[model samples]
Target: MRAQSSATGRTAKAVTPPHAPSSARPAGRGAGTGAGTALALSGVFCFSLTFPSTVWGLESFGPWSLVALRGVLAAAVAGAFLLMWRVPLPDRRHWAGLAVVGGGVVIGFPLLTTLALGTSSTAHAAVVVGLLPLTTALFAALRTGRRPSRPFWAAAVAGAAVVAAFTWQQSGGALSVGDLYLFGALLVCAAGYTEGGRLASRMPGWQVVGWALVLCLPVTVAGSAVALALEPVHWSAHGAVGLAWVAAGSTFLGLYVWYRGMAGIGVARASQLQLAQPLMTLAWSYGLLGEELTWAAPLAAAGVLICIAVTQRACD
Candidate 1:
């Protein structure tokens, strides 16, 4: 769970903003592992809330509009925080990394999730999104040249099978195209989380996220402008409420907490904590969307939890 080292005994190259410090090799392993696990659990809870809030927000706004507006608002909020704290701006080197991270997390992931949920049930989305840990682990291995143990891969494969079975049962044996897109979204978000974790360790969690959003403001604004130009947008009371909740709670607050957790923890252990998200999403979907929880729900939940436990033990 500690920051990974490359094969050459160097720090693994992280796709972080220029102002962010390079990954640090922990001086003591025990303390670092414990801190990482705690932070990762917090990140899991924050991420679990995203899907339910997205379902609420999408009741009114178009997917593109919802994502674009969320990014713009999130960036503004982050900017205000920076000004108040007098945090120094990131230098040019960090800007490129911020741009990539922001585009992946702020623009791409939200947009994809919103679009997929337009056609698929939130429960379906949850099951598919559970693969994020596997994706993050793959990215970590590729980036750090650290090979995971065989049991880790076995658990991941078993977890995917459980999710696949759940999805098939929920859909009555037919897979929706939206399911594929949602899985793609999970992969992209996983990469962002992994890269973001590396940067978070170097800067204050809020600063890392705030500055990245600020750096990506121009792109967000441009995207929002295009959506507005093409659509006759009317903000209803419900839409306004939804947007307010998503902007304040999901985008701003959720991301702040997630980055804080990542800053304290490394990416691999943090990814393990994401196993909780599918369960939370399933609960919210059943309550709010009136979705029926099939027998698959309990079975899939058990399997995913077991896989996470196995992976955690392997890491230990």
Candidate 2:
């Protein structure tokens, strides 16, 4: 997930120019920090609901249907927004990066995670995905040529260790097929997040995701048609709502804010905020799916939150 701007294709205005007067610097910095943090947190909240929503969707839609339909549906919404604002196509030079974003975020992650949810409980899948923040930070560092502080790495590592330990304990120390799918999702999604954050610095965060979704429209449309034909639909209220949330809330809106936040705050710090996401998903799973909440949840959540605080303070 990803940054902010107007519907008319403006980039984020939160950044303070290096040429700005010293007297104006502090206020500009403060505003940018506050807005960036809020946007990142909003994205986290939207994503936290995804696993539970996917589980609910699986009740009526097959994994393939759920994944393809979510993409198609999200694309339609993004396409409409782009047209409404007359957003121009991205530059040719940016297409390769956009392809990575489209392939990974729009295609790879959703498909793999949906498949994983078939066998794994939302809580288990969520904790596994908790590895995403660190993965994304590593990707951002390599791709964007920005290095975070050693303290930040220490906190990020500690958080990942907590999540890994929790997943291992929950899964009885054996990797399931679902775990394999989730790990795959983690790697691809991290690449997408890092690239999306880079692109957001040049364009509106919403447009980066908007264009990526639009770029995948052809494949998603075809996939949706074929998947709907093959998958048996058993539609219900939960299924309908679940599909709607994943498509609208998680895919488009979540990514828009997330990319913008990354542009505002830097990808590494924005990603650390996601340490809260798995815990939020755990709560959603318990409440929405009535899945058993384990005793390990509180311990893991506390550890992750402390890590988040440390990383946030550790500086870029």
Candidate 3:
């Protein structure tokens, strides 16, 4: 859980005990919650294109370069907004959480998933990341003491199991290095989302994301430099467009709305909205990357959607 204290400095615990009882719950199924769900869905839509975009980017840039350059570009946009709005610095108590968000979301997820994408098809990667909602909920419950009801957990597990089974069937029931990377991405990204959601409650979602991007500027700038120097580059129309989308749409705008959604709805409830992301990604992969649309996808989508509906009701 976040340190709930006054503006005056005071020692406070940053995380909840593992067995901590659920102290947080969704307020109700109100207009604000509905709006939050909508915002979260929009973010999911943006993110659904990420794997295809990264595939396009890899045509010109190496995995390291694409990941680092996107971070630099995203930070530049975020910085411009922060300057225009004259957003003040976050409290010191929040910086640790911001650091976690920067490391996991900005750096870790992008790099790991990009590497995984070099070997794995976008459809495969999307199905694997379908597990993210459950991972995020687990992190949120641990970090924020927000425990969802048993029905919510059941629905979450069902959604995740559907995705996992789909992934397993697709991968021939074997683990690859790409699968390992995706799993790692899940852990770090989940932690980042949980922390970002916690921080969003104290400030505007855009500010939370903007500041985290700014916080990682130095590392990203240097990484961009090193990656460009070492990796060969070939400029292309698709590469440029892909880079632009991942930077502006996925990294900046998507996260801004996502954190906002998590702030409006509780983190656990908001996360379940991502159950649709893999299906959306599958559609994108088929259309954009010309990946084969597996027959199992439709079934997985049905199961995931039902789970999402159940989780939303259970949360309420």
> Model 3 over residues 165-227: C-alpha lDDT tens digits?
987887799888999999999999999999999888776788788889999999999999999
What is the C-alpha local distance difference test score of candidate 3? 0.85
Query: Against the correct fold, how does model 1 do in TM-score?
Result: 0.83
lDDT of 2 by residue, 1-316 (tens): 1123334455434443355322212211334788888988999999999999988898889999898989999999988877765555665678899999999999999999999998988888888888999999999999989899899999999999998898888889988999999999999999999999888877778878989999898998899899989999998999999999999999999998888888789899999999999889988998889999778875777778789889999974
lDDT of 2 at 232: 97
Q: Spell out the clash pairs found in candidate 1.
A: 17-94, 18-94
lDDT minimum window of 10 residues, candidate 2: 20-29
C-alpha TM-scores of all predictions: 0.83, 0.90, 0.90
TM-score of 2: 0.90
Measured over all alpha carbons after superposition, the RMSD of each candidate to the real structure, in angstroms, is 6.7, 6.3, 7.2
Cα miss at 202, model 2 (Å)? 0.2
Pairs of colliding residues, candidate 3: 1-16, 1-143
Which stretches of candidate 2 lie above 4 Å from their native place?
A: 1-31
Per-residue error (Å), model 2, residue 125: 1.1
The parts of candidate 3 lying over 4 Å away from their true place are: 1-31
